[model samples]
Target: AQSVSQHNHHVILSEAASLELGCNYSYGGTVNLFWYVQYPGQHLQLLLKYFSGDPLVKGIKGFEAEFIKSKFSFNLRKPSVQWSDTAEYFCAVIYSSASKIIFGSGTRLSIRP
Candidate 1:
């Protein structure tokens, strides 16, 4: 079965630290990748997405992800993170062959003020 994997279960960093969360999916056919962030007491929101065209897509809040077809990876990165960036990040994929979206367990990001 196709699935998404988030390498980091939990990540802790001080303010202004660079952040990189690894995400990889197992799918052979065409797929769409997305990164979602859920803040404390809030619903999940779209952070960034890669559907077509450019492999690198930028989203809200200075977050970006690269869709590497060869590696089956869509890793999220931010140059510097702030305390407000603390949230749970999820990697999701939608395979063309399937109608449902598959999501990774998610990575919890805790930023130290």
Candidate 2:
């Protein structure tokens, strides 16, 4: 079974501050990683994903993630965050042999204006 872990349960930052959320998985096989964000009243939206090809993947809303195979990590990052970016971020993984997506505990990002 595969599982995702998000070290930070809550994060606070001011507007324009850099953001980096930690995300790691426990799978060693072929897998796909994804970063999803859920706003205060909206559904989950795909931020970014890494399936194959380039290790660095750019996602919506100026977000990006790098697939580090050796470390089993797919950390999400953004150079500058905005108040609108405030949301609950989730790290997910889907193994090639599995049909379900394993999601992390989730990290709540709070941005101050």
- Model 1 misplaced regions, further than 4 Å: none
Clashes of each: 0, 0
**Would you list the C-alpha lDDT of every candidate in the order shown?**
0.95, 0.95
Candidate 2 lDDT, tens digit per residue, 38-92?
A: 9999999999989999999999989999999999999999999999999999999
lDDT of 2: 0.95
lDDT over C-alpha atoms for residue 49 of model 1:
88
In candidate 1, how many Å is residue 48 off? 1.1
Per-candidate TM-score against the hidden true structure: 0.98, 0.97
RMSD for all candidates, in order, please.
0.6, 0.8
**Residue 14's lDDT in candidate 1:** 96
**Per-residue lDDT tens digits of candidate 1, residues 26-101?**
9659999999999999999999888899999999999999999999999999999999999999999999999999
Report the CA-based lDDT of candidate 1 relative to the real structure. Answer: 0.95
